[model samples]
Target: MATYLITGATGGIGEAICRRLAPLHSLILVARDQAKLDALALTLGGSHHAWATDMGQDGAIDAFTARMESEQVTLDGVVLMPPQPHADDNPMPTPDVWRHLFQVSFIGPLALLKGAVARMNPDPAEGRRAKIVIISGISSAQVLSHYATANVIRTAWVGEAKTLAFALGSRGIHVNTLSLGGTLSPWYRDKLEERAQKNGISFQAQLTIETDNVPLRKYGEPAEVAIVVEGLLSQFSDHMTGLNILHDGGFTRAY
Candidate 1:
């Protein structure tokens, strides 16, 4: 069975991915909450290890990679799900906020991916080329003035992943980013609830407006996104790389 590392493993979409792949893949769950990770590991009923570390902290990614190295864990794939940026109406947040978001979302994932690439590409005989799936927001391509950090850094990450895809191809590693939008997860539920309360509109009303904008006319489920992640991690996508896939229910029309 292939082994995969999933960062932000306790989040809504992360949890769904774990559930979807638990039967097939060996997972290394990384999250900020030890209790939640432990609970998930138990629920998954597999030989999985849970690592609790704050990605926002300096050297945290390095420490996790080192631990995996010391334990002689070879990963076949990695799914990076950074902390979701809270929607801030500000077009530009304070410099400190931007820095914090960049560190937590972009820099930390870059460090983890760098470390994993070294370990995952040591030998061609071990398995298929290492697969990397970066779960980023739709703001990576679409303009979201409110989510400044996500709009900027996540977009940068798409370019970064494309570069890595080319650089790592000869080493048998593939990299791709998933630009997701309007998924029906806990994170969005809370954000929508807050917006509804603030606007004095019903939650369903707000949801309708958002969903109506999409060609699908509905919000995507976490499981729907998980299926795409599974494909990226599997041999089904061996020929695909350097792709910034839009999982936005036809919300983004850019060609």
Candidate 2:
């Protein structure tokens, strides 16, 4: 069984991934809330380790790596999904806003990857010895006026992932980004609910309006995301690397 470190282990997508991978692999769950992480580990019913780590905090990444050293947990893969600040809250951007956003969106994840490499690398195997998937939003591709900071910061990750793929491929490590869109996460559902309230319409009506452009006319399920992540981490995608997999419902227009 493989050992994987999943940052942002408390989110809906993160939870689904843990459930999907729990039966087959050993998991290192990381998040900010010790209580929540411990509860999740309990529910997963395995020897998974939970770490209450805030990756955005200074030195947190380094500390986490040190802890892993003590445990001697050699990771076979990593899933990066550190919680980002809600840019919608600060519609009017400031220098501090941009700096904080960049640090969280870009720098923190990069540090995570750097730490993950030491745990995953130097395998004698001919094929991939490790896989890393960055869980970014479709804002990396499409524009979201509400998430002003995200549109720019997340975009940088795509380029970074590509470069790392080429640099790390020879070491039997694969890196990719999974960009999601219109998923029924609690955050998205709340946004739809708010719109429905403002428009004096039913939630379904608002949802229909929001998803009109989607060919599937539906939001991808959390379980579906788990399945896709499973594919990315498994040997099924051994030949794939350095690519961004768009999980949007066929809405992105750019070629």
Q: Listing every candidate in turn, what is its Cα RMSD in Å to the true structure after a full C-alpha superposition?
A: 2.0, 1.8
- Local accuracy of candidate 2 as per-residue lDDT tens digits, 37-149: 99999999989999887777768888988888888879889999856775553556888877777777678768877887888854637554689998988888878878776
Give the Cα-based TM-score of candidate 1 against the true structure.
0.92
- Report how far off residue 82 is in candidate 1 (Å): 2.2
* Candidate 2 C-alpha RMSD relative to the actual structure: 1.8
For candidate 1, give the lDDT of residue 136.
Answer: 87
In order of appearance, the predictions have TM-scores of 0.92, 0.94
Candidate 1 lowest-lDDT run of ten: 119-128
lDDT of each residue in 199-230, candidate 1, tens digit only: 89999998888788899888889999999999
Against the unseen true structure, what C-alpha lDDT does each candidate score?
0.86, 0.85
